[model samples]
Each structure stands twice: as structure tokens, then as C-alpha cells.
Target: MSHKPTTVAELGEFTVLIDVRSPAEFALDHIPGAINCPVLDDEERRVVGTTYVQVSAFEARKIGGAMVARNIARHLDEQFRDKPRDWRPLVYCWRGGMRSGSFVNWLRLVGWDAQQLKGGYKAWRAHVIEQIAQRAPALDLRVLCGPTGSAKTRVLQALAAQGEQVLDLEDLAAHRGSVLGAVPGRPQPSQKAFETQLAHRLAALDPARRVWVEAESRRIGRITVPEPLLQRLRESPVVEIAAPPDARLAYLLRDYAWLGDDRPALADKLDGLRELLPRDVLAQWREWALAGALAPLFEALMARHYDPLYARSQGRHLAGLPNAHRVASDDLSDAGIQSLAGHIASLP
Candidate 1:
């Protein structure tokens, strides 16, 4: 029997979840733990679509069906050879159409219980978007506000260590939320993937308990925070952590030491600020990067660029900033972050 699951909740019952969309489609986003078993390779999908539009629907179907069958045979021989007869799998494609239907039908014929998601990946994506829209407003969000290099992310980690519910958005987005915020050797997730991650994280929290998150602009790298969640963050009461310039510089130096190791990459990132800063200033910054004089460069960046930008942006976006609870720390060491976390957790 083939099960047709209309909603993502029903997908939880399956032991295995498979996305039968093209690899390109699966790379964009799918269910969190779903494995990709593309029914059609990227090139084949494009060929089929072109054939469908230019030749005939029947011709396209004939070609696509043969390709899907060959791929399914390979999957059975390689990916599923060891599976028991009783193994159950849930499969989906872009629209729960022929792609997943063909896969599920074949699996059922092979003596396994197989189900097709009723509306497929499209349905799951819609559910995620809806979840964010519905649950974001209900969350008890505490926005953590501070200028660059204030160790806001570190403080969030410390808070989580104490069992606080914290939404580490940068972790989810795979970005630090700045031009130079890219993590070393870590590529950011596709926008849809980021949204799926955000939806799942937000879903696991208790609305009754407070949730802490760093204050971020609407955009984080190539991904944008969903508007409803962004609105909640902007409206939420803030806990502002203020650290001295020297302390902030030290934290930046220690935390971003990786940038020093890649002087060319660092120089390239600085070059992106060409429009914002004078060419002469950018050249000087690049010189410091190449010379490994990061401390002085970081000090100048904070004082001249990031600090002023943060002040103006926070004032404009965080309308509730005036009432924000302020906590000052002279050190951003682990102990200092833990202390700040304790203070934030104790807030009324």
C-alpha cells in the first residue's frame, strides 16, 4: 500500500525519507534528514523539460520514464541492496508527481512499504514558511544587541550552556552577518535551506520560555531572515552588552585569527568596502592585512566603520533600544561571557 502524506507531520512515521527531485533541486532544500536519490540527473531533467516544450509530451514522458527506471535500478543495486523487505521509506519530488510516484511504485513492488508525500517538496516548504509565520509571533524573544566584536555569539553559546533556549542565527545561516563574516572553509546554505533550518529550530522551542537571539539585520550573507521572525526580533526587548574598545579589539583578534592566515582573501573582502570607504583607506587596510598588523587594522575598522554603522542601524531598526537592559563588561573571556549570560538570564 502506498501512503500519501499530506503534511510534513505525517512524514515523521517513515524510517527513511528520500527526495527524488533532481540533485540541483535537492541541493536547494528538502526535509532536514531526507536523503537525495535523484530520479533524474540535472542534465536529464533539463533535456526532458526541453523535449516536453519543444517536441511532444508523450516523447518527453517516454524518455524521462526510461531515465528514471535506469536510475531507480542503480539505486536498488547500490543504495538499497542491503535493505530488509520490511523497510519503510517516504519519497517526495517537486510536486509529488510522476518522479516520486514512479519511485514509490517501484519500491512497493520490491516488497517494501513506500509512501509518497501528497504535495511533495512544495508542500513541505509551504509548511515551513507557515510555521515561521505562525510561531514567530508567539515566541518570547530576547534580542542580544552589541556592536561588532562584542562577542555576542560567544555570549549566546554561554547562555545555551546554561540550558537557555537560544536561537544562534549565525550558526544556522553559516554566516557572521557581515561582509567579512564568512566562516573559513564553510559555505553558506541555500536560502531555502536556511529557512528550513530556521523553521525547525523555531519549532522546537517553548513559547512560554524566553528565547535569546543575536540582533541581526534582515540580510545574513545571501540568506534573509524571514520577515515575521525579523519583525519579532526588532520588536523584542534587547539586552545590550557593552565592552571597551581594547577588549573588543582583543576579541576580534583572537576570534578572527583565521583571516590573518589568508591575507589575499582578507584583502579581497576589504576591497568590497571600496564604495563605502575611501580608496586610500582601503589600500591602507589591505597593507595592514598583508603585513599581519591585524590589531591596528581591527581597531581602525571598529572605530571608523563597524561601530558607526552598528549605531546608526541599531537606532533605526531596534526602535525598542531605549528601554534595552544594558550590561557592561571589561573582558570578553569565557568567564566574562558566562557572567553576561547569567545577567541576561536574570533579566525581568
Candidate 2:
């Protein structure tokens, strides 16, 4: 029985859409729910890419065609060896190109109900752009603005725990939104992966509810927010959480004390600040560095850099806010978070 190609959206809820792009391409971006099942492994994709760029198109096709066939044969022997006869698979590649199309053809020939995404990942990307762009404009957005170490993430978590709608943009991007925000030893995903993650998270939310999110610039590392999301955030309500300088300093010290123990890592992370800080300030920070007074230096660093940026973002956001509130909680303890949640819940 010849198998027909299926639109990914048409794949019944149980159908699995497999991504056959190389790991690098897939990492940059892919459909939200798709799993990586490369028909051409990393090295083979590289070889094919190079051949297409350097050698004749005919030669590249000949080599790529054979390699893809071999990969399919191996899958039948190993990974797909036990796949049930009724297993329905939807496959796609970059732009629904030849790699996925070829695999889909092979799977269909083998008598399973296999199909390919009509436009592959390209179609998925378009869908994301359209939804985020048009729908976000009408959202009741809430921007969670606060200084560094003010427990913004903690506040967001508590809100979610209490059944309030919240979006952890940093978590979605697998980033922390500051030089010190990087999780220990975890590499960030590619920009495409970040968007895919963001879109999936957004799609799962009910647009009728207010979406609470941490205040962030358009960019986190190399990943930039899509235009639609940025536009929506621009007009959202801004709530600033104020803390005394000492309180902010203490908070930062507690959150980032581990980085202080490693001077080399600290210096590397601070390298970007050289252009912004004066040599004297840098020397002062270094003196604190040598004396292991990192907590104080970190406080000074916040006042000098992070605080200013936060203030500027707040200024632009405040003007557009239909309702802005200032919360004077520095530590944001359990009671404080619960109180804040109650306040937000009461809002119309």
C-alpha cells in the first residue's frame, strides 16, 4: 500500500512528528513537540552540506541519496526494528526538504501510515509568527519588574503555585537574564530552540487570563524575542518591586555567593563590564575581589550597571502601563508572595 503524505496538524493527537534535520539545525529551532530522529546523522549532514557547496549538485545528490538509504536500512534493523505495524509517523526536515520527503517515501513503501509535513518546520515557524504577532496584541499582559536579587523568579513561581497565570521567559530560554543568571554549567539552547520553547509555552496558556512575566529586554544571550512578543510586552502593566540598597545587596550576595569563590570565573563573567565601568571602579572591585569582599563589590556592581538598566526599562514601560503598582517587599517571603498573589488576583 502506497502511503500518502500527511499535514502535521492533521496527524491525530497520537501521531509523532519526527524531525530529521542535523542536530545543529534542530538545536537552532524546530517544531515544538517534534522529537529528533535524524535520517542523516551529524557527520553525514556535514559531508552532504559540504558537497552541495563545493562539488556538483549531481554528485551531492548521488552521495546524499545513498547515505540516507543506508540510515533508513539501519533504522529498520535497530531503532525502528520493534516499531509496531500500526505506528503512525510524521516526518519533516528543514523546509520540508528532500531529507524528510525521502524518508517519508521509504517509510510509506514499508507499509506503515507514515507521512511528511507539507512545508515541514517552515510551516510551523510561520504559524508561530502569525499567532504571536496577531493574538498577543490583545492580551492582558503583566510585566514583573524588579531589581536584581529581588526574588522576581521566586515571586513568579509562587504565583504559578497558587494557580495564577505566569510566563517564565528566562526558564523558557534556559537562561537567567543576567551575567550571573547562567545556571551552573548548563549551555543555553540555540535561538530557534528558544523561540520554539516560547511558542509552545504561549500556546498552552489561556489568552483570557493575565500573563505575568519577568521584565527583560528583547534579547537574552544570542536569542532575541520575536517581534510580536516584544510589541505585546511594550504596552503591558509594570509592577516595580522596591528594596533598600542594603537589602538588594544582601539579596544579590546570597544568590550569587558561589561565583565569588571562583575568581577566574567571576573575572570572565565581568569582562563585558570593562567598557561600562571606569578603570578606578574596576580596580576597586578587584581590591574587593582580592580581599574576598565580593558581596560588597557585587552590591556596588548592581548600582553601577544592573540597576541603571532596570531603571531605563522601567521608565519606558511605566509610561505605557495602564496600571502600575510598587511593592515594597525586599525579601519576598512566603507571606509576601501570597499577599502579592492575592493582590493580582483581585485585579479586573
Each model's TM-score?
0.96, 0.90
The alpha-carbon deviation from the true structure for residue 305 of candidate 1, after best TM-score superposition, in angstroms, is 0.6
C-alpha RMSD in Å of predicted model 2 compared with the true structure: 2.4
For 138-231, candidate 2 gives per-residue lDDT tens digits of 6677887777867788778878987888888888776788876776766788776677677777777888888888877788766687877787
For model 1, the run of ten residues with the poorest summed lDDT: 1-10
What is candidate 1's lDDT per residue for 212-249, written digit by digit as tens?
Answer: 99999999988899999999999999989989999999
Q: How many backbone clashes does candidate 1 have?
A: 0
User: Model 2 Cα displacement at 152 (Å)?
Assistant: 1.3
